[model samples]
Target: MPPLRTAFDALARLRDARAFHPKGARVDGELTTLDAGPWPLPAGSAQVAARLSKGAGVPDGFRDVLGLAVRVPLETGPWDLTFSTIGSLTRILPFPARGWCDASYSSLAPYRVGGQLRWLLARAARDQPKVDASLRAARRLVRGGGFELVLSSATAIGVPQPIARLRLHTVCDDAGQPTFDPMLNHPPGVTLYPDWLTKARELAYAGSRAGRA
Candidate 1:
């Protein structure tokens, strides 16, 4: 069988076995808009299904990963976007005390701006004396439309440029089991980089599926 098909089969078996929900404290949010930009994107709203959990199953309140799975309707069809707090572009994992608001998201293993990639990361508020202060500032930004989503180079550190902004309307009940396959569920113009990291991810996804199955 083809490698792609083999990977899909593994993911399918995992789904059938009901084994995809080991981590992530799921939450609900709204994808209000694309946040006006140069790129051509349909103006529509979609539900944001997200998961907040530690990257290494560490203790709560430690450095964690925020997973966002969005399915947006477009002229072509449904466009799905899957991103993580710790961007794949970066090799270093963020420190635990960095907090969620300070986390970042990226697309493509190698970062590039204006390349059909939507990256999100929070910048620390200047002059904040404490971590809590920064967290509060981040929270306020999200609440007040100050949180910006931009297309730019993915960095292990530094603020992401603003291309779009997300305002989380509410937190809904978790979806019992949610599965996201970038290979099967990406937007029309977006694609994974042809790189070893992408291949590794495919294998990891297949392995996770098989393990769950």
Candidate 2:
């Protein structure tokens, strides 16, 4: 079977198994806001300008004015994943000169559960034809549109479902090449992980039935 097909099969089975939830604590992050109405260095020394003047760059300016931040923990697992309920984009003009894109992702935490979803997904790809077909479709979507494959994870709570939502904000140059816009590019998607508590409840029920037998 093709490599993409194998990967797709693993993801589907992992999703079906509902491996999102595990036992853990609720996850959260520091709060941040967007102050400047838009970008391109607005007019007067507005609140955003004041902050920017004292700072070196855009991300830094946002951190001061809007209280935005970068994901510090980098490679280690995330503290929590944010969910996106709504998303939108728009263009603004007539002043300091600029354009903007926006997106929001809510947040949640997944308890530390065994990587059952990961294991199942890996097993499914062994010889699944349907998985291959899905992979082909996904590849077409990525090429036709502009998308990059990041990573695919599984959860039990919203297993077989999507919980977190992500939004990307970019700044376009004269040539139309988009540069990174820290203010808007955050918590890329809405993510739903399984709830360990719920999983435990279900397990308890299953155990009770076995005892009766």
**lDDT to native, each model:** 0.46, 0.22
Over 104-191, each residue of candidate 1 has an lDDT whose tens digit, in order, gives 5544254223554334343333332222213333344344533333323334456544444444433334356455566555555555
Clashes of each: 2, 30
lDDT of 2 at 128: 19
Q: Which residue segments of model 2 deviate by more than 4 Å? A: 1-76, 79-133, 147-213
- The clash tally of candidate 2 reads 30
RMSD of each: 6.7, 21.9
Task: TM-score each candidate.
Answer: 0.58, 0.18
Clashing pairs in 1: 149-163, 150-163
Best by lDDT: 1
Candidate 1's TM-score: 0.58
